[model samples]
Target: MKQTDEVDDLLTRAGARWRADQEAPPEPDLEYMLSGGRKHRRWVPALAAASVAVIAAGVIAVLPDPKTPTAPTAQAPSTTAATPDARTPQTIAQGNDDFLVKPGDKVQVSGKIIAVPGKTPVFCPPLAVPDIGYPPGKEPAPSCPDNFAVKLNGLDLGQIPGLSTIKGVLSGEATVTGTWRGGAIDVDVQTALKPLDHPAQTELECPVPPGGWKSQPSNISSTAVTKFLAAHAYQATGPIFRYPNGTSRGAPVVILIGLAHGDADAFRQAFEKVYRGNYCVVPTLLSQSDEQRVTNAIGDVMSGNPKLGIYSASGPGLYGGRALAQVTAYTPEVKAALTPAGLDLIRVIPQVRPVR
Candidate 1:
C-alpha cells in the first residue's frame, strides 16, 4: 500500500528469517533456576531477540538495490599555469642573450646611455674593419656591441640639463623597444629616457672647480689680471686658500692658479703686476695630457724632489705655465713605475669652485 507499510513489511520478513537461522540458547535446568539463577537467565533470551530485529531493520534501510539512486560526490577546483609579463623591465646584459632570440628579432631592453668621446652621438661604436678600406668620400657603417647602443628616434636625451657635455663620459637611464641587427640595435616605436641628477665624473680623479672668470687676455693685460684674481679670490666658503709660502712667511704668497689659456710667462707677469710682487704658483690640469709627464711631475713632488714642469691650460684662450708642481690622474702605469722607486703616490684631488 504506502511506502512506510512496505518497508515495515520487508523488515519483518527479514527479522523472522534471521531469528530462524540462529540457534536458541538451551533452557536452564529447573534445579539451577531454583538456586537463584532465574533473574539473570530470564532477560538474556529477550535482549538477544531484540538486537537481531534492530540489526535487520538497519540493514534493510541502508542497503542499495540495482535500481536505487545515489548522491553525487564533490570534486576539487581546477588550476591554471602562470606566465611572465612582457612589460616587466630587464637589465641590458640579461636582455642581450644571443641564444634567446635570433638576429633582427624585436625585443624590449633598458640600460644607461653612456656618452663616449667623438663628434658623433653613438658611444662605443664598432671597430672599423682594417686592411679593407672604405670607398673615397663614403662613410663607414656605424656599429655597436650587443648591449651598447640605443636609437635616438623619439627619444630626447638633451632635455636633461645635467648632461653638460656630449664629448665626455655622460650617462643616463633609457628603455627602448628595437630590432637587434648583428652589430647594432635599431630602436623603433616605444622608448623612454631619464637623466640622472648628477652627471658622471671624469675617469681622471681630479676636482672640477666652479665660478666663471673672464677669458685670459691674448697678451698680459693688467685689467684681465685684476678680474681673474677677483673671480678666484679666497672666499671663506671656498676650498682654495691664500697660504704663505713655506720658504718665506708673509713675503712670498702661494696662489693656486687656475689658468684658462695663459702661458707661464703671461700668468707670472699678470700675478706680479696684480700683487706687485713675486709669488709661487700651483696650477691644476683640467684636461687629459701625456700620461708619462704627469706621472713624473706628481712623483717628484710626492718624493720631496720637486722638478720644473709645464702645465698647458686651455679655455677661451690658451695659457701655458711652468709651475713648481701640478697634479693629475695617477693611473696604473704611473703607480707601477713610482712604487719601485720608493715613491708614495698619494691620491690628491684639486679643489674647484662651482661655475657661477
Candidate 2:
C-alpha cells in the first residue's frame, strides 16, 4: 500500500511539471521562414542578369548607321583646241577643262598664225587702228571726235578677191592661233584657224589723197557717217598685219576722213603745224564724190604691198558737235548695243596738252 502511494505522488509531480511547460510562451517560427527566404535569394540574382541582357539589346537597336565613301564622276572637246572647220574632238582633256566658246556664240579674234590643218578661213573682228584722219575742212575748233582714240584701227571688212581671201592668205592646211574674245563674254579664249599661212607679208594702212575721193558724199558730215578725216592721225602697218578678208584696189589706205568745207585750209595748217614728212599741204576739193575711189583707196591700204597712211587737213565739226557727230558717224555697234552704263564706248577728245 505504501509503495503504491509513492508512485502516485511522483506521477502527480510529473504531471504538474508538464502543465507548467504548457503554460509558458510558444517558441518563435521566424528562423524557419528566414531559412526559406535565404534559399530563394538565388532566383533574384538570376532575374537581374536576364534584365541586364534585355537592356543591352534595346540599346543596340537605336544606334545610327555608318557612312560609306562614294566614287567620282566622268569629263567633253574645246573650240579653241580644234581646227576652225574640223569636227571638234571628244577626249579626256576636253572633259577636264572648261572651254570659253561653245556652239552658236559670236566671238572676235586677234592672234597670229601658228599651225593650220583644216581648210576653212578664220575671220577677225574690226581691230582698232588709230591715225586714220578725218576729211579736210576749216572749223573753229579741232574736228576729231571727243572719244576718238589714236588706237582706232580698221576692221576686217571682208576679203580682197584678187589679193587674198582668207583661204589663200592662210593657205591650204594652215594654222592660226591668237587671243580671241567676245565683247559680251567674260572669258578670254585661245583660238586656232585652219590653212594657217597664206597672206604672207601683207600690210594694211590708212588711205592717201588724189585717188581718195572720186565723188563727194553729201552725207560726209552727217553724224551717221563712219568715214571721216583727222587733222593728225596714227597708222598701223604690217609684218604682223594680216587680212583675213582680201584687199581693195587703188588707194592702199583705208581712210576715215572728216569733212568740214572751209575748215579744209585750217586742217592743212594744223597738219603742217603738227606733222612734217611725206605729209604735204594739199588744197581741199569742193567735193569728194568718189565712193569707188574711196573704197579702192582703203583696199590699197589693206594690200600687203607698199605700206601707207593718210592725213586729214580740214574738219568742220569740232568741239561739242564733233563728239556727237562722231558718236553718230562711227559708233554703229555702240549705237546698236546701247546700255545706260556706257562703259563699252570709249570717248576721245583733244585736250590742251604739249604736243609731242
Candidate 3:
C-alpha cells in the first residue's frame, strides 16, 4: 500500500478500537450561584464541567400563553456564524461569503489532541466544541466504536509527533494548519499554543480621578458583602474590577462594586460607613438569578436536538443582562428542535450557521 494509504488504514483501525467512559457532569456551586455569575471571561469550574443549564419548575412564566398570544414577533438570528441557509460543501468552498471552509480547503485550527487507549489522536476543537458537552440529542462520541472525527467538519490530525510518549488522554493544545482532505485534515504545520505574557489593557467605565483610585481598607468584610449580595440576588451584582486607563494587565487592581437598588444618596450612605473605595449602584434590568433561570430553561430547549453532535456553550454576557448560548451548528431542523425557547432573556448563536 502507498505510505499515505497505510496511514489512513492505521487511523481507521485506531478509531474503531477505543471506547471512553463518561464522567458524570458536576453540580452547581451554591456560592458561585450567589456571587453573581461571571461573564464569558471567567470559567465557573463546576458549571463549565457539567454544562448545567436551568429549566423552569413548571411552564416558563416568561413565555406567552399559547392560547391567546398576539402575532409572533420576528427576531433576526444574532451571529454571522448562524447562516441564512443550511450550508453544504460546495457552497462553503465556492462562495467566499458563504462560510469559512469546506472539503479540500486549507484551514487552521487550534485545540487539544485527544487520544484514548487504542484510538489515534484526533484534534479536539477545545474552544469550538462547546463546554456544554454533547447537545441534547447526541450520544457521546468518545464512547462510540467507529472511525470518529474523520469528516469534513472535523480535524483528524493523523499521527502527530509524541503520540508514542503519552499514555492517557489529551495531547495538550496546539495550533494546527492543514488541507481538508474530505475525511481528515492533511497536516501542513503544527506548533504549540503560546501563552500571552501581556494581554491588552482594559479600562474602567468610571474615569480615574486625578490621584488614581486606591483600595482602602474596608471594615465591611468580603464574606459580609457576599452574604449581603446573596440575600439581595434581585438587585445586587458582585464587585467588578478594571485597570486604570494605562495600567499593565496584572493587579493592584481597582475595585468597584454595586449593591441592590437603593437611592443614590442611600447607596453612598450605606457604603460610606463601611467602604473606603469608589462604588456605584445602577438600575437592574435582570438579576443573575433570573438569567440563570432562563439559562437553565434554554439548556432544556437546546438539548431537544436528536440529530446528534451539535456542541454548545452558554452563559450570561458581560454587559447586557442577556444569557447567551453558542451552538456548533444550527439548522432550521435544529432551530425547530429548540422550541418555545423563544424567551427574550436569552440569545442562541450558532457558529456553523445555516443561511436562509
Candidate 4:
C-alpha cells in the first residue's frame, strides 16, 4: 500500500493492538514462525481473516507484578486512544517489533518493564514471547493477560523505578527513554505506554463507480467464485476493513484485490461477472504464489539457523512484495545467515537493535 495518512493511521492503530490488550501485547511462546513452515505455501499468519491490508501486530509480552494473577488473561480490544509517541516515524518504518530506539543513542522508545521473580523489575523490550496467546477469533491481536511475554532482547537491566516493590509481571507498555551503556540502556524516562484502538479505515487505488459501490444483481456460488479466482491467478489477502458500516444485513463483505499481472479494470470486470458482491481490484508488484515461493524458500533455509533468534516469518503483504521476519536482534550473524536471494525477498526485524 502507499502508506497514505489513512493507511498510516490505520496501520498505526493496528499496531496498538500489538499493544497488549488495554495496550499491552500478548503472552510468550509467540512463534512468529509460520506454523506451516514445512508447508511453505501459506499467507502470513499476521494477516488476519478479519480484514484486508491489515499488518500483523507487533509481538510483545508482560512482566511480573506484586500481585501475581495466575489465570491467563485474554487479549482485549483496545480501550485507549492512540496518540503519536515521541519517537521517529522513519525509524518505526524500519519495522522491528516496534522497538523505536537504536542502541547507543539517548533516544526515546516504547516497550515494557516486568518483574523478575527474585530480582528487581527491569525495563525490557515488549517483544511478544512464547507463552501468551491472542484472543479467540482475533488472530493477530495479542492477548494482554497479567502474564504477557517480555523478551530481554540481549539486555538485562536493574534500572527501572519502584523495582524493590515489584513482585510479578509489570502488565503494560512503557515509554522508555535511555542510552546504551555496556549492556543495559541507561534509563532516562519511563512511563506507561497508553494503548489505542484499531483504525477502521481503508482505501483503494481504483476510483469508485458512479453509483458509489452499490450491490449488483447476479448469481455466483462460492465454489465457482473460488475456481474463477484461482483460474485467473487470485491471491488471497488478509482482512483489513469493514465496508457499509451499520448494515443490518450482517457484517459487510468488502473484497479488496491486488493484481500483479492483469489490468485492474479488466480484473474487476471479470470478477464482477463471477461474483455479485463488493470488491476492489488494484495493481500490485507480487502475487501470492510468488510470495509463497520466496517465503517457503526462507523457511527452508533459515529454519535451523542458531542464535539468530527467528521469532516469526511471514510472506509478502498487501503493502509490498517483501516478506517480514521478526527476530531478536539484527546482527552480523543474522545478516550472514540469509542467502542473497532470500535476503532480496525478506525483511529481518529485530526486537531490539544495537547502537549502529
Residues 3-95 of candidate 1 have per-residue lDDT tens digits of 123233343333332322223323122222223332211111211322322322111111111111111111211121111122221221121
Q: Model 1 off-target regions past 4 Å?
A: 1-99, 117-156, 159-167, 193-356
Please estimate how well model 4 matches the true structure, expressed as its whole-model Cα lDDT.
0.39
lDDT values, one for every candidate: 0.28, 0.21, 0.36, 0.39
| TM-score comparison, 2 vs 4, better candidate | 4
Better of 1 and 3 by TM-score: 3
Least accurate 10 contiguous residues by lDDT in model 1: 309-318
TM-score to true structure, per model? 0.18, 0.15, 0.42, 0.49
Clashes of each: 16, 74, 13, 39
- TM-score, cand. 1 vs. native: 0.18
Question: Where does candidate 2 stray beyond 4 Å?
Answer: 1-192, 195-262, 270-278, 281-356
- Candidate 3 lDDT over residue span 141-187, tens digit each: 33211222332223343434444223244354555667754335666
Model 3 deviation from native, Cα RMSD in Å: 16.6
Between candidates 3 and 4, name the one with more favorable TM-score. 4
- In model 4, state the lDDT of residue 346: 51
TM-score of 3: 0.42
